[model samples]
Target: MSTNTPAPVGSSGKGASLARMGVFTLAMINVSAIVSLRGLPAEATYGLSSAFYYIFAAIFFLIPVSLVAAELTTGWPQKGGVFRWVGEAFGTRLGFLAIWLQWIESTIWFPTVLTFAAVSLAFIGPDQRWDEAVSANKWYVLAIVLAVYWSATLLNFKGMRTSAGITKWGTMIGTVIPGALLIVFGLIYWGSGNKVDINMAPGNFFPDLTNFNNIVLAASIFLFYAGMEMSAVHVKDVKNPGRNYPMAILIASLITVGIFVLGTLAIGYIIPEAQINLVQSLLIAFDKFFTIFHITWLGPVMAVCLACGVLAQVVAWVGGPSKGLLQVGYAGYLPRAMQKTNKKGVQTGILFIQGGIVTILSVMFVIMPSVQSAYQIISQLTIILYLIMYMLMFAAGIALRHKEPNVPRTFRIPGGKHFGMWLVAGVGLLGSVIAFLFSFVPPDQISVGSPTLYVVILLLGAVIFAGIPFLIYAMKKPSWKNTDSANEFEPFNWELKKTNTETSAPAPEQQH
Candidate 1:
């Protein structure tokens, strides 16, 4: 198959055309994928300094990833996402590793987000104490997580059309509406002269840099901005991607930061720092705000909305990285069994395998000492795994500048020569490396049981998950490749170059 073929276009019965997406739609897609209200409460505990973390992460992680991905996606515009970009830069082995981390980090991340969904569902009940009790119950959390996750996986089986619709509505009702409401309530509270819990002092806006413990939770901010790269896959779909992608990123970043900062401040305004619970704080903040507004009845409605948002987020993620991995599998990286697709062309086998992993991880709720600890541990693992991929991605961005200088880029980072690529991607790489190292330090805010266990789990988990792609690459058989020429994955550029060089080399001197 031709590697450089433009993305397929259509306008007929067998292949109805997809309308090209514009800036607003793409921006909202990025918003839906990256903005999770649940994280606000944790950051809220940082008071004014939360804004610092938000801005820092946006600059170092969010913007860099989005810009780098835009360049890469537009330049390649191929079936594989990171797999294609990194493969072109480094080679297929590291390329597979990048996509593997993307998929697996997201896979491990399912339980933590679902756990938040379970908590939101728990709060739908009348009694707050009863809600807390149910939320804390490992069995209930596991049951809800599995039910919601598997349900989403099954729904995705229908195809992207069904999934996209849910994400759009889910994000509106669940994320945008709730965030706006929280900010409005905070405004009303401040306007009404109720005391603000967070210090507005100028000095408090920046976090204390000296304390390592103080900065440990900041590592997770990278995760808060993690999935922006996922949206880059659609760079080809956007009109004038060079212009539109950056506009979308700018608009989406501002809106996202606004929602996060205001939402966190709203929660901090209502719930005291001591009372912030990672899973329940967002819901609790909503409940408290509604109580003050004398709209206690809206509490359950907010719970349902947030839960829907979480479900929508899950549905989006469930299909996304798996689709990329499926393309790689079709290219002969995975065993033949993994490449199976359903009637709708969904990756049924891979989706089921993903679900199975989620199911196994959800079971950890039962074995861990507490649901919160389990959530923290899984979240940290996700962050570290994803950071490794980001490191590879940033390095790949810089390397590609040198390796394929003449490749036409619709958009390029600003500086001349390697300077722009290095500055943007270099900062991202440095930030990711710092976060990855800091991720090993357990936050003192929670009782993670044993520091030794936490370190061991993270180190081992990263090793095993990151190492699997290499093992798969080693075991890959030529027979595993899809025989259909149309569906075949394009070989890496390096592979083609090596072939050309070998073929052009002068014949070896005769032996005698």
Candidate 2:
């Protein structure tokens, strides 16, 4: 969270110490927080080239985000995670946009993720045809998405301990175990005499760079590596903040990339590229693998695990951004209503409003032709907004290096102070720019119904969603400050400087 705490994700307190924490535990937490089977099928469509995208995204985007965010977190160390980081570099308004994009992207992300859970739930039965048909039904998907999302949202009202349990168990059972099984099953199938579906030639390792639509879909692969920024705060938890921190991050990166690359290859090896259905292909691949091994009952069990994982992920994410938004609201960016919390200090008003937005966006399932297409459309929009936020975050990192060079960061990006910042943040910014531009182009891989409507959804969603924050920032009143005595959000450094300069200024006669 922009608030710079893990409690929003899993922990109920600030963080733990090296006595109870180690490199491996931190690495696995990064793995479980980030690794998801829902996205394997999308990358699998690229066959051997999927490995390239995953590695590329990790180097240019994933590692840089964690590194840059770590620097920003230490430098600013303010309550508003992104809001504090960006506002310190730019101003409160752009800072507001940064946090808004994060919150909105996550809100839009729920239904798409839950769509996978819906499909997982639908495919829990042994009959493939019936399961596929049911998963494709928009109404069924919608009902499951709403029901499950609402359940997670409601559970959030109970506070962090409840969701933490769901996230912990869900990540292991749903993601880790299933991901291992997928790779093992693929190796087993390959070890036996089973035929491979995708081309294994070295030439197939690189995608057609000229194909704009191909890159458009591949742009989404950047997001698959998202959410590792949480690891940055753990730098202090390990023995050597310098050595062990980067090592843990590197190990986690390798593990995360390994799971993604191997898992994607596993799916592509079995399912023909043409037969890949974003919503159903993962479940189908599992069932196919089980059928080959003559143990078909595990298909439903895998679905249950995957569905639970997605649901648990929803529970984990439900309140994080909203809480950041809530903190910002307390600082006077949002209405009093949105700033309200329940007895548990949960951001109920914002959560309820987020749920409403999700309910509306979930309708895209019906408006688009198929579940995959709808998923693709919404996903494209999510990437665009998120990439914009990333671009701002990256640029903010660079800007602050120049603007506040003496701020005494606990961790630096490594190289020279300024040059290293440039190298890392620049790469992240460039990658984000490329992906941001490509997100507007509709992918040829999925049927998005109307290209015009698809573009409209992307353009309008980006413009309107990004535009809303400035409107709220402009509308904020001085009286909007946090009413709570204990949790008064800190003012931005610029805000304090402006006050100081004003205080030191002379009267008109005195100045003359």
Model 2 regions more than 4 Å off: 1-16, 504-512
Please list the C-alpha lDDT of all candidates, in the order they appear. 0.83, 0.84
Cα error, candidate 2, residue 360 (Å): 0.7
Candidate that would win on TM-score: 2
Q: Tell me the RMSD of model 2 versus the true structure.
A: 2.7
Question: How do the residues 1-512 of candidate 2 rate in per-residue lDDT, one tens digit apiece?
Answer: 11112322333345556566787877766666577788889888899999989998898898899889878877887688888888899998899999999899999988899999999999987699999999999999999999999999999999988888887788778877998999999988887867899788999888888866667788898888776665566655556656666777899889889988988989998999999998899999999999988999899999999898878778878977788888888888888888889999999989988999999999988888888898998888888888988888999999999988888777778888689999999999999898888888888888888889889888999999999888888888878787777878888777888899999998677554
Instruction: Indicate which candidate wins on lDDT.
Output: 2
Give the lDDT of residue 209 in candidate 2.
84
- Clashes in candidate 2: how many? 2
